[model samples]
Target: MNAVATSSADVDAIAQVVAAVERAQQAKDAEGFLALFHPDALWTTAHGKVLIGLDAIAEFTRAVLPKDDWDGRVTYEVVHTQFLRPDVAAVKVRQVYHGPDGGSEGAPLYVMTKQDNGAWLLHANQNTPVQTD
Candidate 1:
């Protein structure tokens, strides 16, 4: 436990960071997406590929983003957030991919760290596929 954020403004700021992620993804802008991550960030794909560092994430993203022609769109909604410290938070997101066929869901957890400059950077994240029964 670090420091808990007790301000509604902090919550709003965190929400902005989450929204930025969705915006970048929707535009397929690799640079925009990478800007949100810390240099030593970790990312685990929904398919379970673990990526360490921004470089690895950038490589993987560049390869996949350009090739995505799924004829669908993705939406990311912040479902919950918990502050671990004043500078760190865990955020859960509900992701939905709407395609021509139907829609698929994902649950992603993003661990964010607030910088000295008051910017929240993604430190670690994991995207999990939602299995429907």
Candidate 2:
């Protein structure tokens, strides 16, 4: 996935990984979401809680995800991807929460690493709420 050698397939695969996150969120499937992360992945919540690893992330998400109700839908769009190396990338995402009452958004950064098996797994991620004036 290096910039020089990046192919459409690589970009598509990365987009799919990002889409999977949105799917898991919509379904409130904690396990499904966790499967996308590396064993030592770090995740920071939009509200600023920092989770150090898979275990901590799982614990937090299992409790919070199920309690979430968007009343409409949520979407995740891959806005950009910067390849740090052939096996690593920094992906920027635009996240939107849509509901009848209106919506909110977040800008998330997901740093993904290509696994030995060639799958892209989230290595580190941060969710920052998009504040509107």
Candidate 3:
């Protein structure tokens, strides 16, 4: 971790990126969601499928997101953020999907990087379903 202090501005920016993700997922807009990712991003789905790069992520998103069968909306909330560097952050998110049946939760960790233009983009992410006993 870089010794630099984490700023509220950076946290706010990261939160905005997360909010965009929620919006995209709720709207089933693959392109909108993909726009927030880095070219070499890695993503692991809640079900354990791993996507290696933007191309692979794009392919999967396009194929699966629109066809999702859940008749409800999903929400993503940023629960914590750790700054690894001035330009990189590891964010923990609480994800919930509410449908006619009930609600399912997920714990997603998103590693995001800030670009030269100061824009934060998702670099790597893993979504793990919350198992209830």
Candidate 4:
């Protein structure tokens, strides 16, 4: 079995993982999105709060996609990375979601964790609303 990596490695792995997340979201591949996470992965949304376990995770993700305004595409950049431990890390990514109708929402901060399997997965995520006011 693979082991968790160092902090830097965790960051690198998560970078890719997050990218894959974007791709999966764009593709609306529910299974693909789920595949990036460990069986026991958890995600805490910015406003909706915590979604624990894979079933909830899948439900949340499915709800997001196929929305009347769902873009299914997200573009983002990693603004910061913090490591709480060798196997544990978090990333703040600046993200924007673009739906099929050309609407967009964003700058959400995404936090991720690298599991014992040496794969980085979404741990928690939140975003400040885009200032349009």
The most accurate candidate by lDDT is: 3
Candidate scoring better on TM-score of 2 and 3: 3
lDDT of each residue in 21-111, candidate 1, tens digit only: 8888888877898999999999999999999999999999999876657642789898998988888889999999888778899999999
Tens digits of per-residue lDDT, candidate 3, 19-133, equal: 9999999999999999999999999999999999999999999998888586539999999999988999999999999987788999999999999998999999999999998
The runs of at least 3 residues in candidate 3 whose Cα sits more than 4 Å from the true structure, single-residue gaps closed, are: 1-3
Worst 10 residues of 2 by lDDT: 1-10
Residue 131 Cα positional deviation in candidate 2, in Å, after optimal superposition = 0.8
Q: Model 2 clash pairs?
A: none
Worst 10 residues of 3 by lDDT: 63-72
For model 1, what is the alpha-carbon lDDT of residue 8? 81
Q: Is candidate 2 or candidate 4 better by lDDT?
A: 2
**Higher-ranked by lDDT: 1 or 2:** 2
Ranking by TM-score: 3, 2, 1, 4
Backbone clash numbers for all candidates listed = 2, 0, 0, 2
Which scores greater on lDDT, model 3 or model 4? 3
Per-residue lDDT of 1-133 in model 2, one digit per residue for the tens? 3345676777889999999999998888889999999999999999899999999999998998887454427999999998888788899999999877688899999999998988999999999999999
